[model samples]
Target chain A: MVKVTYVAHDGTRTELEGDPGDSVMSLAIANGLDGIVGECGGSMMCATCHCYVDDDWQAATGARMDGEEDMLESAVCEVTGRSRLSCQITLSEALDGLVVHLPEEQV
Target chain B: MSAGRVVIIGAGQGGLQAAMSLRQEGHSGPITLIGGEPGLPYQRPALSKAFLKTGEADKLALRPESFFATKDITLRTGEWVDAIDREAGVVRVGAEALPFDHLILATGTRNLRPAIPGIDRALDLRTLDDAAALRAALDRPRKVAVIGGGFIGLEFAAVAAGLGHEVSVAEAAPRLMARAVSPEMSRRFRELHEALGTALHLANGVTEVTETGLTLADGTEIAGDLVLLAAGVRPNTELAEAAGLEIANGIAVDAELRTRDPRIFALGDCAAFPEPGSGRRIRLESVQAATDHARAIARTIGTGTATPYAAVPWFWSDQSNLKLQIAGLADPTDDSVTLEDGAVLRFRDGRLTAVETINNAKIHMKARRLLAAAPVPTRDSLLQRNYDLTAA
Candidate 1:
């Protein structure tokens, strides 16, 4: 199990063990992390699963897939140098302790 | 003799909701819900996702078998509505005729089976049974060819590809979901599908749909074991047309969702109600629209005078982890601004046409309320609050 840390919009942080091969969004949703609606379920069709991958983990996380990158265009929070959709990022053994910053809303 | 009965044709999402609303609004008249498909009414949105995984048909039912009995709502499944006798105010189902005080056509839309060769081999995802059939086909490993890069096609493609099936989407349009989304959004989904190992072909038209493969307009045959038709949908307006009610792209209805005949009201995918925003009649196939239309129709039946159906249009699509949400309707001509946070807001001239959001439910919901509110939001109010449209 990979250690996943989610930083809430209000600065509260929660950490959970994310199953390998499962997406960060699914993990967040599974753990009942607020602000992540995951309305489209896990489909990239909606961008409600936005999260900024913590800077420390950006180097570990590779480039965003075209679908994931394109979907980030509609996210609410600034997808600055570290923005990424949690649904698009699947956890692996390589991503042991990944940190993702939660966005303000996931409609 | 007594109050007239309201017979709703096509017991889909909209039809079922209309029946419930009619009953909820305290309409004492008889309610008969008829459906062409067998089994209880079920939600179609999950037909592409959860149902595909579980293959549990029982869970898909919108209302249990006992729902009809408890609600005093007559449900006739496995029977096709043959015609609508406007004069008699009744719908003919084979040898039987169900009379109605008011006819509500909720026949919804059907998948457009394109004119192609080998069409018999392809499967559909419109109905619950169709999704079950496709789920069965998924048990084995094979290449799936999806026709029409619309929502269903792309959605199924995402699921199939995620499940490790090789998938391909052939779209005749220049971009995927071109009619529904902005160019930027289209490009995003296209890229996402590509990265997921699903092959996408745009600007390519299909001339023939074969069981083993598909023949493109350019005479290119794409090999496949199964061809799924996600080719969009056309409103089921044949019954209304035969009845001599006005038929535009869909069954034409005035502001009150009443067809030419004042006694007939329509909603959901079948009826083309005057667009709340554009005022140029449009038909939508979303749960929100169907539910809202049912509520609006209920208000009329309950009180007296009916108000126009004016509900903010919002949509959501799940594609392999990316949840795309749209708070408003944006046309091709609408101008789009990419905010600092990457949220794409569409504007028609000066007014906000729509808000395209991915993973940002706060903005999406806020935008919906803002658009639906009495006072339209200006650019400053939206931009001032750090691009938060919900900010007053």
Candidate 2:
């Protein structure tokens, strides 16, 4: 199991354990985590699962693909250098203790 | 009063959503979802995208089979709805007739095949089986000829090209995605496809689909191992038409998404509802439109709230690395102004009609919220702000 921490916009952090191969967006949805609406069900067609990776874990998350980068540009919240779409990030054992910040709105 | 029985036809996105939303809206009525296709309803949009790359049909299911049983929703799969017996308030599937107090028609659309000789030789990319066949065809490197340059055609073309297969898109329209996107945006996509090594044959209609390839209207022969027919779609309006429902391009529905027969309603690609603000009836084929329409209809049926369906329409297309997103609707003749950030703002009669963006989700979401505002921003105001939507 990989432990993932989702930090809401209000600075509230919720830690959850997910099996490998489960996408961050799917994990959040499964746990009923607020602020992440996987409207397109991880298709990457919708940008409703936008999140900001913790600065310390940026390198661990790897680089965003062109498709994901394009999708992040459409996120409702402010997209900075750390912005990423949670659907594109698959949970893995190496990603244990990964921390991501949830945006205020996904739309 | 007891919640009446709700019957839904065509278990696509809209049909399934209607059943789920009805229950969410506190409707305790018997809900029966009849689908012509086998298995639980899956996401159709992925058939042309991820399903092509992964070839995983199981991931496409919107809900697990157990969810239906748990929700007490009766799901009838592999059963084609033959006719609607309005007088008896029942839908006929062969000899079986299921009674319903209220009906929701979400029959969806079928691929529109052009009148080309040997067109049957071409494969489609609409259903799960079609996608599986397409994925199998992509196993070996071979030339692929796409008959249309629309979203599905381009998406498949991009995927096929990315897999190192030679691809050529033949579009009858002078420009790519002529009906849905602006000319500038179309040109951008044309370049994107060309850069990916896919050939673009604009304004070239297929006259014949030979076993080996296709022949264009101008007598141009394109050789390919496989041909994909993604030209367009025709709404499944035959069911509604036979039932004596108003059909204008699609089954005509009022602002509240109700058909002329008060007990029945239509939504999604098969229903032509009046466009907000303009009042001109338009048929939109998008997941957002279908889901929102279902929610609105469910509210009316469950809570007695006949709130007019007025959600802003949005759509997206993924081709190669480019993600083109459009918020709100735009007429083909709408005037467009390109912003400094590469987003296109479309306007009709000085009113903002749509915003087209390539990989820009922030602006797209803002455009949706702006369009849905009580006093919509004007084109002049947008121009004055140099297309800064936030300023408007």
Candidate 3:
């Protein structure tokens, strides 16, 4: 199991565990975390599951996918350099303690 | 304002979201969500796409069973609402009459069964159970005949073809998905489906569902062992009509999605509200519309603010490695210009109406943002910008 911590915009932290193959967005959604919406069901079509990777965990989380930046244009929040769609980030054993921060709102 | 009992009919995506949104807006009122289908609320989009291929029923649930208990919501499944008592503010469900301070009608839609002979022989793909039965039928190698070349039929054809089934699609229209997508998109998808080895029969209507397969209106017969009815759906408005609520194409509602009776509201696929800019009555059957409408209605009930439903409409369909996305709505006469990047911009009366893209998420997203602005980008504006959505 990989451990991932989701920090809300107001600095609330939620740590959860998930299998290696599961995506971070799916984990947050299954746990009922209000941050990520994943409206398109991890199809990378809807950017509602946008998140900011913690600076410390940025290297471990790697880079965005091919169409990730394009989908982020539809996000309701500001798109920063640290921005990443959580649905594209697949969980793996290499980076277990992945800490990510959620945006103010996802609609 | 008193936190009175809020009763929502229909447990589909919109109905479930209404209950959840009311709680999110801090409405402490008692909430009851009634659904005609059994089990928890599940999404219908994947029923024709991934669910048919993976048969993963567990992943379709919108929320867990514990969600109702934790959120203090009364979820009554496998139940049908008999009638609405607007005078007494109660709904008849079997022998019981559930009262409500405010009533929401989210009664979605049902499949349209044409008067063709032996139509009952063809199966439907509306609910989860229908998808399950269709999946079970695909367990063996068989010739699959799909009626209607719309989103559902084409999506199912792509999957069945991938599964090594002999797939053939019959569409009554001249092109595929004529009502939803632009002509350019229809042509592109026709090529895509053909490349996937699926046979396409355009401008042909099924006159009869014969024992062997389907007989076209031209008297040509297509042989198949399994038949699917993906024609279309009709809004379920009988209950609202009998209750004396105004009914147009659907239940007539205002910008706030409320019926003539102040205490009654209708939404989702069953409500025909005015369009944001055009003020034309229209009804959409997409997840984006349903969920957005639910949020708008919940805010009106929760915070006492009747904000108009103004979310930009968007839709998507997956077929054989192609992801088609549309950012806005378009009429039948809308002119389409295909950009160099293969994105189609729909224009009506010089203003941009919709954007259709295949696997081009950036352009689609940018089009959505541009369409929602105060002054939409005009056709000449896009042409001057070299059809660049980011700048427009």
Candidate 4:
């Protein structure tokens, strides 16, 4: 199992396990975490799954995908350099300790 | 309505979102989500788009079973709601009478069965079971005839074509997606499917659905092994209508999403509320509108504070490699102005209506923000800024 920690805007932390092929957004949604709406069901049609990778884990998680930046423009909160759509991030053994912070709102 | 027992009829996206949002808003009352479909509530958007290719049913689930159990949400699946007793404030489900302090009608829409002979021969693609059957039928290379040129039909056609099947789309309108998109966009998509070897029979309505395929209104017969009925959908307003609730295009609701009866609210594809800016009654069949309406309804019931549902309407369609996104609402007669970037700006009576883009998500997002702003950008104002949504 891959361990992922989701930090909400209010600083609440949630740790969950996911399969190697599962996405962070799907993990948050399946576990019913308050943050990360995943409104588009990881289709990247909606940016409700926007999240910020913990700075230390940025390099391990890699950069955004081809069309992720454009989709992020529709996110309800402020977009940051570390911002990435959680749906685009697939879990793996190397990134077992993936840590992501959720924005204040995702509508 | 604060902290009252909430009963939602329809466990689709909107219904599930209402239960979640109610809990998020700190509602402590018992929440019952009744769905006619068997199993946990899942999203319907991907049924025609991705599920046809992947067949990953687990991925479509909006929430896990554990989430419902932990949230104390009573999810009754495969249960048909018989009727709504407005005077009694209870809904009849078989022999049980489930009472509710507040009832949310999110019945959604159903596929429109046109009055064509042998229509039963054509398979539907609305539900997961329907998609599963269609996907199974596509296990072998088969000639496919899709009756409709709208989003669902085109999407299924694209997937079937990509899978090496002989596909043809017959649309009754002169142009594809005529009701939802502008002429230029319909042209672009026509060119796209044509390039993919999918024959498009525009302005041709299916006169009959035969075992071999479909016969068009123009007396042309398209031979195919598989026939898909994707003509369109009609709002599921029978229950609302039978209950004596006022219904226009759909179950009529106010700006606050409440039906004539204060304790009941209708929303999502099943309900038609006044358009935010124009006050024109309209019904949208998108996940955005459904979930957004659910949130607004939740706010009113969960917190005892009513707020008008004025979220900017947006939609997207994935056909082949192109992503057609529309930011706002546009009438069939809205004027279309194509920009150099290929994004079409729709206007009516000199006021900007909707922004349509193909494979351009940035401009689509910006257009949504612009449309949501007060004093909506005018066509002349947009022209001065070179049609750049960020400038306005």
Candidate 5:
């Protein structure tokens, strides 16, 4: 299981354990984490699970694909250079200590 | 008056969301979710995309089994609701009669099977069971003949071709996705599918489904091991229709998502609600519409706030490397303005009706917000800024 930390907009952090191959969006939904609506269930169709990857772990998260980048641009929250769709980021042992900040709102 | 008990039919995305939203909206009432499918409500969109690629059904579940138990939501699966007893205020599931203070019809839709010889031989991709069967068929190398060049068919063709299977798409219309996209966008998709090695048969329709292949209307035969019917879908409105509720393209609902009987409401693919700005009765099959409609209905049922449903409609389809995102609604006759980056802005009578983007979610989102503005952006306003929606 990969240990991932989801920080809410208000700076409230929730550490959760996610199995490898599961998306961070699924993990958030499974654990009942607020601020990650995941309306489209990781299809990248809905940008409801927008998250900002911590600057330190940005490189580890790697670059966003064109599809993912397009989704981020449509995200209800402000898209930053560090912004990423949690659905596109799969949980892996290599990124065990991943930290992502949830946006304020996801429409 | 708050609903004492809410009974939701179909138990799909919209039904499940209505149940969840009711609770979230502070409705401390008994919620019963009845589904025709055998298991929990799962994400239907992933069945064609990620689930086909990964074969992980568990990952597509919208909520875990424990969610219902914890939330005091009663989920009954594998049961088909047969009829709605309007006067009795109950729904009939075979011999059982389930009563409700308020009833929500989220019966969703089913694939439209054309009246062709041996049409039963063709498979569908609407349900999880259908996807599972399709996936099992894809386990071995097989030739796939898709009946429709719409989103589902194209998405399935992409996956089949990606998996090294021979695929052919037969679309009756001159262009692909003709109902939802512009000519330019359709041409681009045709190119994408052709480049992916999927044979395109546009302006031609299947006349018959043979055991080994399908015969076109013009007597052209396409050889294939498996046939898929992705032509389109029809709303499941038998219950509402039988009960004497208004039925047009779907179950007709008013601005508040209420049927002729205020106690009965409908949403999702089954309900034809008026388009927010245009007032045109439209039935959407997207997850965004389902969730948004559920939320609006739940708010009205739970908090007694009869706010008319007005959320922006957006949709996306993932076919191979291309991701098509559409914001707002567009008719086939709507004029389109193509941008330099390949995004198409649809306009009707000078007002923006929709925006279609290929792998451009930023512009799609911008268009959705812009269209939802108090006074929608017009053709002049958009052209003045060169279609830069953010320049408001």
Candidate 6:
């Protein structure tokens, strides 16, 4: 398990522990971290799980795949280099203490 | 009232999502999610596919039991809400009358049972329980006749055919999924199903249902070991209508999903609201619409997402080798332009309205993003870009 911080639109931080294989989206939802909606259940079909990975956790998460990069474009706010779908990122030691920003809209 | 205690009726996708979204949007008020179905609320999409194939009922749950405690949300499943007293804003489930400050109706939809003989012979695929029963029925050797060539019927036919069972689909429409897909897409799907060894009977509406078989409009009786009904759905508007709420095709709602009574709101397939990007009104049966609707209601009741909840609509269906993804809503009147990438962009007048893609996720996502922007791409420019809609 890994502890991660989810920062909402209003700048509130929710720190929670997530299982290794579970996604950032699933854990946020399982923990009720607020603002993270994994509507498609990690099918990568719906981009409701969109989130922003901070600079500190970007490299560990690696570059977005073609499928995710394309979906991220449709995400709520302007897609930055840091934007990523939380569903694609699973919890791992590499992401311990990782922090991601929830977009203003991800329903 | 102080938004005192928010009471949500119906624990399907929309109901569960209503409570979850409300809390997510920062509403700390007393939130309750009540579902008529037993056990945890699960997704209905898999009823005809994965669950029908493997019978893995456990995986389909929308959330774990601990989620309620963690989020401080209350879920009352297997309990039915008998009445909604709009003026007093109290819901009755049998003897208990639960009061509410704001009542949300996410009751969703149910299978439409057509008036046909021997209707009881056919099985359904709407709820988790229904899928479980169908899975057991598929165990024995049986020839299946599916009524209604919509997505659910076609999906089940494909799976049953793939399982070495002889399957036949009888649809009243001239083509498969006529109500949901374009003619081109429908034709393509027809060819795919036929190639999979499933017999297709277009425009063959079931006139009469017999114990051993179903008689079509053309007077042809197709014999089957078992019959399945996938005749589509009708909104569960009894609670709303009984409560004196304005009812159209569904419970009529404004831009905010609020019912005629401002204290109550509705969403999902049961709530027919004005279509964003277009003035037309429509109801959608998909996970995206339900969750999006839930979030919108939550924002209004929780934090303030005061902008008229104009989120773009999207949908998807999985059948055998094809995975159809649609972004936005379009009707038959919309002029459709097919892009070079096998993606079709639909438009009403000159405005882009929806995008249809098969097995092409990239184009689908791009189309959604493009439409999200104001002054969406037009048919001319979209064609110029070879339908590379991302050119925006």
What is the TM-score of each predicted model, taking all chains together?
0.77, 0.88, 0.96, 0.98, 0.93, 0.87
* Interface RMSD per candidate (angstroms): 9.7, 4.7, 1.5, 1.4, 2.4, 2.5
lDDT of 5 by residue, A1-107 (tens): 89999999999999999899888899988876777889988766768899999998988889996568866766777899999989899888989999999999886
lDDT of each: 0.80, 0.89, 0.91, 0.92, 0.90, 0.83
- Model number with the top TM-score: 4
Q: What C-alpha lDDT, on a 0 to 100 scale, does residue A86 get in candidate 3?
A: 96
- How accurate is chain B of model 3, given as a TM-score from 0 to 1? 0.99
* Candidate 5 CAPRI category: acceptable
Q: Give the best candidate by DockQ.
A: 4
All-Cα superposition RMSD per candidate: 9.8, 4.1, 1.6, 1.3, 2.3, 3.7
lDDT of each residue in A1-107, candidate 4, tens digit only: 99999999999999999999899999888888878899988878889999999999999999899779989987889999999999999999988988999999997
Off by over 4 Å in 4: none
Worst 10 residues of 2 chain B by lDDT: B58-67
lDDT minimum window of 10 residues, candidate 4 chain B: B383-392
Clashes of each: 30, 4, 0, 0, 0, 1
User: Local error of candidate 4 at B358, Å?
Assistant: 1.3
Q: For model 1 chain B, where is the 10-residue window of minimal lDDT?
A: B58-67
Query: Can you tell me the CAPRI class of model 3?
Result: medium
- Model 6 steric clash pairs: B11-B35
lDDT of 6 by residue, A32-106 (tens): 555776777666687788888998988899988657877776676778888898989988888889999988887
Per-residue lDDT tens digits for candidate 5, residues B1-392, read 46488999989999999998898788998899999898888889988897888888877778888889888899999998888898898888899998888999999999999999999999999988899999999999999999999999999999999999999999899999999998989998999999999999999999999987989878889988999999999999999999999999999999999999999999999999998877889999899889999999999999887979998888899999888989988999899888888899899999998899987767877787888898988899888997887686
lDDT measured at residue B388 in model 2 versus the true structure, 0 to 100: 94
* Candidate 3 segments exceeding 4 Å error: none
Q: Best by lDDT, which number?
A: 4
- Better candidate number, 4 or 6, judged by DockQ: 4
How accurate locally is residue B18 in candidate 4, as Cα lDDT from 0 to 100? Answer: 95
Ranking by TM-score: 4, 3, 5, 2, 6, 1
